[model samples]
Target chain A: MKCQDVRIELLAYLNDELSSEDKVTIENHLSTCGFCAKEIVQLQKTERILKSGLESWAEVGEKVNLTEWLQEESRKLSNKEKKKEFTKGFAETKMLKHKWQKVIRFAAVALVLVMLMASYWPQLVKASTQMPWIGPLIKQLVLRDAGLSWAYEHGYMDGSLATVEQDGVKLTVLGVIADPTQTAVIYLVDGIEEDFSVYISKINGDGAASWTSPATKTSVGTIGIAQTYPLPEGEHTLTVILVEEDRDAGRRNERLSLELVTDRENISKLSISYDLDQEVTFDDISVKAKRVVYTPTQIMVEYTVIGGTGVGGAIPQEYASYLLTESGEKLYRVRSYGSHIADGVRELYEVFERPADVSNLKMVIPVQGKHQEINIEFSEPTTIGILDTDIRFAGWVHEGNMIEIEMHYEKYGRVKSITGWSVVDEGGNTEELTIWKGESFGAYENPGDFAWVTTKYELEETDRPVKLIATQVLTIVEGNWEIILPAIN
Target chain B: MTESEFMERLRPLEAYLYRMALAIVGKDDAQDVLQEALLSAFVARKQLRDPQYFRPWIKKIVARQCGKQLRNRGTVFPMGRGEEYVFDSTDKGKRPEDHLIWQVVNQLPEIYSQVVILRYLGDMSQKEIAEALGIPEGTVKSRLHKGIGKLREMLEAEKGGLANEMSGR
Candidate 1:
C-alpha cells in the first residue's frame, strides 16, 4: 500500500476498525516507513490528548446537582401526593448524595411485568378487599387516576393472586384494577432489597400493552404498574422476570420468572358515564368533547379539534389540555394518543387523573398559539421583546473553561413552556445549548405571550458573533375554553 | 428504571457523558445538559429493554439532547481560562491550556469530532460509537480515520515550535 493510503487507514487500523487484510497491509507498510510509523504514534498521542482534555472538562459532571433536580421534579409532580413524597424522599437520601448521586444494580433489559395465577401461590387471597401490605400503594395509584382509593376501601379486588417463591423472591398481587380505558397492578414482593433492576420480562396478552414500574422507590417490595390502555379483558398469560445482573460482566447471571394467568377484569365494573355534546372556542380554535368515559383507573376523553388543526401537528393545546378542578387544581395526564383516523377526522384520546371529588369538573382546552423563531445577536447583555414577553439575556459567568450565559424571560403564567434554543460560535462550531431552569421564578399575574423563564447555557469557547436562536417564542392566541363535564349516572 | 438505578448506570458514565456534552455544548451547559440528558434517559428508560444496550442507549440520549442545541448561528462562553487545563489528572506544574489535541479536535468538523469524542472520551468501541451516533460501523471507521488525520495535522501545525505536543497524555 502507498504511504498516503496507509496513512489514511492508520487510525482505523489502530482502532481495530479495519479488516484483517487491511490491518496486515497497514502493519506491513508501517514496518517499512519511519514517517508513516511516526505518524501512527502521533495519531495515538492525539487520541490520548483529546481523551484527557475532554476528561478534564467532564470532571464537572460532579457539578450537576441532582438534588435540586429531584426537588424540582418532586415540586412539579407535587400535584400528586404519593409520587411527590416518593421523589422528594429520593432527592434527600444520603445514598443519592454520593458522587454523581449514583447507586444500585443495572438491568435495563426488562422484558415487561409477568403474570400470576390464582392457584399458583399457597397464600393467594381472592375476592377480598383486605388491603395488603401494599394495597394502599395501589390505593394511591387508583385514587389518582382509576377513580379514587375510596373504591378499594369500599369494594374488593377482582383478581388478587400471588406467586410461589422463585429466584429468592416472592411476589404477591396486592391489587389489580382494570377499566376499559386503563389498567393498574400493585404487587408486593417479599425479597429483593436495593433497587436491583426488575423487568417485565414477558407480557403475553392478546392485545399489546406496556407498563411503567418505578420500583416503588419510596416503599420497597411494592410496585405499582399502570397504563392508559388495558390488556385483553380475559384470562391472559404474562410473566414478570426479575434479573440479577453482574455489572462487571454486563449480563444477567440469575433470572427468576413466574408465568401466571392474569384474569384481566374491571374490578369495580363501574365507569362514570359522562357524555358532553358541547363546543368551546378560544380565538379561531374550537375543541369539542366527543366521548368522555371515567374509568376507575383513568379519565378517557375523545376530543375533536374543530379549527385547531395543524397547530403543533394534531396536538393543538396539549400542554394546556387537562382536567381542571373547580378549586383550580390541574390533574396529571397519563397519555395522549392523537391519531389521524380518516380524512378530515382527527382523534385525540387523552387519559388523565380522575379526582374522587367529581364535582364541578371541566375539560379545559386552551387556544393553540402561533409561535415564531427568533435569532438574537448576543455578546453582551441584550433584551428582545416578542409579543407580551420580554426575554433578557442577562450576563455571562466565566468559570474555569465554561462560559455560563444567563437568560431570563418574563411573561404570563400560562405561556411558561421553554420552546427550544441553540448557540453557535465564531468558528462555526455549533453548540448543544442546554438552557436549564437555573432558579425558580415565583408566580406572575400577567397573561403571557411566551413565559417567565430564567435559563443558562455553558460554552467552552466564546467565539464572538454569537447567535442564540430561541425557537418557537411567543403564543399569539389567548383564551381557554372550558366545557363543564356533566354526569349521566 | 428508578432514579437510583438510572444514576447507577449514569455513575460510571458521569465523566464520559460530561465530556461528550462538553465537547458538544461546552462547560457552562454541561451540567445542565448532563442533567437534562439524564432526565431524558430516565423518562425514556422503558424503551431500553436490553441491559447490554444501556451504555450506548444513555450515550445516544445525551447526544440527542445535545442535538437539540444544534442551532448553527451563535457563539457562547468566553472560554473560562481557568477551566482550560491539560488532560493531566495530576495538578503538576504543567500549563493546562496547552491541551493542543483538545483544541484541534474541536476545530474538526462535527462529523469527525463526534466520532472521535465518542471513541476516546466516551471510551466507546467503534461499533458502540456507530450505535450511539446511529451511523453504520463502516462509516464510523471512515469518520474516525479522517477525524484523526485532521487532528494530527492540526496538532503538528500548532506544535511545530513546541517539541512535546502532549506532555500529559
Candidate 2:
C-alpha cells in the first residue's frame, strides 16, 4: 500500500472501523515505511487529544440529580392527576345536586353558596388586608419595602428630616438606617413633574454605596429613593443627587444635590463581637478560633490553622466548623471567604446563618487528618508570549469542548487576576473564553522554583487554526485598610 | 409499553438523556428538555411499537424537544460560556485546549454534531446513533468519519500554528 492510501485509511484503522483485510494491509505497509509509521503516531496523538478532551468535558459538564429531579417531577404529575380527579368528582356532585334540587331547592342553593364562598376566601382576605387604614399596618408588620417604614419598624429610623430645595424641587431625607452589612437612607422628592432620576452621589466613608432601587413615583407629588451601602460604622455624610432631563431639549432641566450627616444614634444595635482564643487539635493540624461575631443575620468565625505537613497542604475536609446550639441542633457553615496566608499561618474566615436566640453555642471542628496531596507534572512546556511578567503554559488537560491550561508563574504571589482570554481563529474572529477558576500561588503543589495555576476555557471547533491570548493581568498590591466598627449592645 | 414500564426503563438512562439535552440546548435548558421529553415519552408510551428500542425512542424525543426549544427561543446552538458548565470536582480542572476542542465539536454542522455527541458524550454505539437519528448505518459511519476528519484537520492546523508561534518567539 502507498503512503497516500495508508493516510486515507489511517483514522479508520486507528478507530478499528476498517475491515480486517484493510487493517492487515495498512499494518504490512506501515512496517516497511517509517514515514507512514510516524504519521500513525501523529494520528494517535490527535485522537488522544480529542477523546481526552471530550472525556474531561463530560466530567465538568453540569450534572443533574436524576432521582431527586424525577421524584419532584413525578410529584407534580401526581398532583395534576389529583386535580383531574377532583374535577371529575365535582362534576358528579353537580349531577347529584341537580337531582336533589327538585326535593330541596333551598338546601341545594345553600350548598352552592358555601362552595362560592370557599373558592373566593383567599381573594376576600387579600382585599381586606389592602384596605387604606390596614395597608400601613400590614406593611409595618411585614417590613415589605426597604424604606422609611421598614427602618422605622426596625428602630433604625430617626424623626429628624433634612430638606433641600433647588430649581423649584424639594428633596427631603426622611430617615437613615445603618448596620454592619448596609446603611439605608430613605428620601422623599417633591415637585417632580413626570419623569426624574435619583442618585447617591457619595457616601463619605469606607466601602461602596449605590441606589438600591429607582426613585419610585409613590404619589402625585412625591417620589422616593432608597440608597444603601455597607458603610463603615462611624459618623459620615451622604450626598443625594436629583436630576431631571428633557429628552426633546437634549439637556438637563434641573439638578440638585443634598448632603446630610447620618443619624448614627438611631442605627440598629444588632451585632455583638467576642474575643475567643479557643484551640482544637487533630492528628495533622491545630486550629485556633480567634474571634466570633454574632449578628441577627449571620455568625462570622475567624480561625487559623497551623502545622499541616506537606507542600500545598490544606485543612482536612473533616475539620470544617459548624455551630451546635444548646438544644443540640447543628448548623452548617453557609459560606466561607478570605483564606490567606499570613505569618506562615493559614488564616480562614467562615460565615454561618445564625440560629435564633442562642446565647451559648459550641463551634465543632472534627479534625480528621491531612488530605493526600496529588502532584501534577507537566510533561510538555509550551512557550507562547512575552509580557512584563514571566507566565508560561506548562501543559493542558482536555475534556469535552473545553481545555484547562496549566499556567506557571516565575514569581509567587504576584499575579492577582487573569482576564480577557480568548481563542482567535485564523479568520481573525475571536471566540472569547472564560477562566472558570484560579488558585493563588502557594495554594498548589509547586515542584519547581515557580508556582503553577490552572485555568479552564471554552473552545470552539473551527476549520482554521486558533491562538490563545490574555488581555490583562492585575498584580497584587501591598497594603491594607482597617475600618473600626462600633460596639453594639 | 405502559407509562410505568416506560418510566422504569428510562430511569437508568436519565444521565445519558441529560448529557444529550445539554449538548443540544445547553445546561440551563437541558433540565427542562429532559423533563419535557420524559413527560412526552410517558404520554406517548403506547405509540412505541417495540420495548427494546426505548433508549433510542426516548433520545429522539429529547432531541426533537431540544430543537423545538432552540427554535422557539430563536437561540443559536451552544449558547453558554465555558464557565457556565463546569465540573463539580474541585480536584479536576479543564484546560484551554479541552475548551477549544469542545467549541470545534459544537461548531460542526447540526447533523455532524448530533452524531459526535451521541457517539461519544452520550456513550452510544454506532447502531444506537443510527437508530436515534433515524438514519441508516452507512450514513452514520460516513458522518462520523467526516466529522472526525474535520476535527483532526482543525487540530493539526492549531498545532502547526503553535509550533510557528514557538519558533517566532
Candidate 3:
C-alpha cells in the first residue's frame, strides 16, 4: 500500500480493524517510516486521553434504579383501580335509590285512582236505581184531534173533570193530571176533534190561561199543537171553554166549558217523555243563475244553488243546470250530477246537497254562444276539491350578466339582471371566472355590455366599505310565473 | 432477540457506542444519541446478521441516531467563519488556551465539523467513516484533511504546534 493509503487506514489500524495482511504491512511500514508511525502514535494518544476522561464521567453518573421506579408506577395504577371500584359501588347505590323512588311513585298513583273511584260513589248508586226496571215508570198518553198531547210519570193519581157552558159554546174537560212532585207537571185536556179556541181560568189560584176564544176554527188534525206551557205550581180550579161563531146571527158564542180540579203537588209527578234524540226538520232547495258574462273564447257564469237544512237535521243533495245559446240557439249546457253517491269533482255536470260537507262552487262556463239561458234543478249534496295556483320563473338580468331565474329568484325580478347577475365589488374585482353560456355553447368574452352576458362575483370583495348592491332586472314571461328572492332589507 | 437482550449485549460496548454518538452529535446531545441508538438496535435485533460485530453495529446505530436527531432538530449554529480547535482530554474546569476556539468550531460549516468529529472522536478509518456517513471515502479524507489542517493553523497561533507539520509530527 502507498503511504497515503496507509495513513487513510491508520485509525482503523490503531483500532485493530484492518485485516491481518494489511496490519502486517502497516506495521512493517511503521517500523521504517517514522512519519506514518508518529501519526499513528498521536492518534492513539488522543484516544487514550478521551477514553480515560469519558470513563471518569460515566463513573460519576448517578445510578438509576429501574425496578424501584417501575414499582412506584405500579402502586399508582393499583390506587387508580381502587378508586374505580369505589365509583362503581357509588353508581350502583344511586341506581338502587332511583328504583325505590319509582316504586313509591307508582304506589301513590294507585292510591289516587282508588280515591277517585270512592268520590263518585253516590252517582253510581243513583245511575243503578234509574236503570229501566228500577225507577217509577213514565206513561205516554197520546190524545188525538184535540190539538194536544198529555203524559204522566212517577206515581201520578186519578184526576177530576167537569163540563161548562159559556156564550152558547160548550167544552168538555178530560181531567187534571198530577206528578210525584219530583220532575214535571202533567196536564190532561179534553180532545176536541175540531179546531177550537180554549181558555182556562183558575178560580182558586194563579196557574191558568184566563182569556176568551176569538173563534172556533175547525182542524184537519192535531199536527200544529204545541205541548210546552207556562204554569205556576199551586192548587187551582180551571174553567175551560170551546167557542164558535153563530154565522146567521153574526155572533160569537161558547159551545162548551169544563172544570179541571188539580193541585201542583200531584201535577209535579208528571214527566214529559220526549224522543228528542230523533231530530226532525226539512230543507228547501232552489236553483237560479246569479250572473252570466259571455265572451267569444270563454263564458264566465256565476250561478248560486240555494238550499239549506231548515228545521231539519240535514239538507238533501240538490243539483241545477244552466243552458247557453247564441241568439236563442243551443251552445253549451252543463249541470251537476243530480245526486252524488261518490265524492265527484264539483263540475257543472255534478250536483250536491245542502248542509253538505263541501258547499258553494264557482264555475267558469265556456259558452260557445253570445246569448245563453240557464236551467236548474235540485239533487244530492256533493263535496268539491279545493284548487290553488303555482307560479314559475323564466329569466332575469343583473349588472352585466344575464341571469336565468325561476320562481326561486323573485326578489331579483325588479332589479336589472345585468347588475344583479354579475356582482362586482366597489373595486370592480371578481376572482371568479365569468362563464358565459357553458363551454359547450362556445364561451364568449363578456364585451362588458351585451344583450346576454355572464359575470362571476367573489363574496369577500364586496365586504369592504362602499357596499355594492346587485341591481336586478327581471323579465316575467308567460303566466303563472313569479320570482322567489328575499326582499331587499 | 428482545430489545432488553440487545441492550444487554451492548452493555460491554457502552464506551464505543458513546464515542460514536459523541462523534456524530456534540457533547450537548451525546446522551440522547446513545439512548436512541440502543433502542434502534433493540428493535432491529432480528436483522443483526453478525452478532460478533455487534460493537461496530452499535456504533453504526449510534451514528445514524445522531444524524436523525440533528436533522430533526434543525439549524446548528451558523458556520464557515473559522476552524474550531478542540482538545479531547482537556478538563472541563480548565479553560482552553483560546476560548474562542469553541465559538470557531461552532462557526465551522457542518460539513467540515462532521468529518472532524468522526476522525478525532470516533477514531474511525476514512473508509469506515465514509461507509457510515454514506459519503465517498475521498470526501471523508478531504473533509478531515482540510478540517484538521485548518484547526492546526488556528491552534498554532496560540499553542506551540507547527501549522503545516503537526499531522506529520
Number of backbone collisions per candidate, in order? 29, 28, 64
DockQ for each numbered candidate: 0.08, 0.11, 0.01
lDDT of 2 by residue, A287-317 (tens): 6777766655666666676754211112212
iRMS for all predictions?
20.3, 15.2, 49.4
Best model per lDDT: 1
Better of 1 and 3 by DockQ: 1
Model 3: per-residue lDDT, tens digit, A118-223? 2342222221122221112113222221111223222343322233433423333323433221112222122332223344433444433232211111111111
User: How close to the true structure is residue A1 of candidate 3, measured as C-alpha lDDT?
Assistant: 52
Candidate RMSDs in Å, in order, are 20.7, 17.3, 49.5
lDDT of each: 0.53, 0.52, 0.35
Count of clashing pairs, candidate 2: 28
lDDT head-to-head 2 vs 3, winner: 2
lDDT of 1: 0.53
Off by over 4 Å in 3: A1-9, A16-31, A50-489, B1-23, B26-36, B45-60, B68-109, B119-125, B146-169
Worst lDDT window (10 residues) for model 3 chain B? B78-87
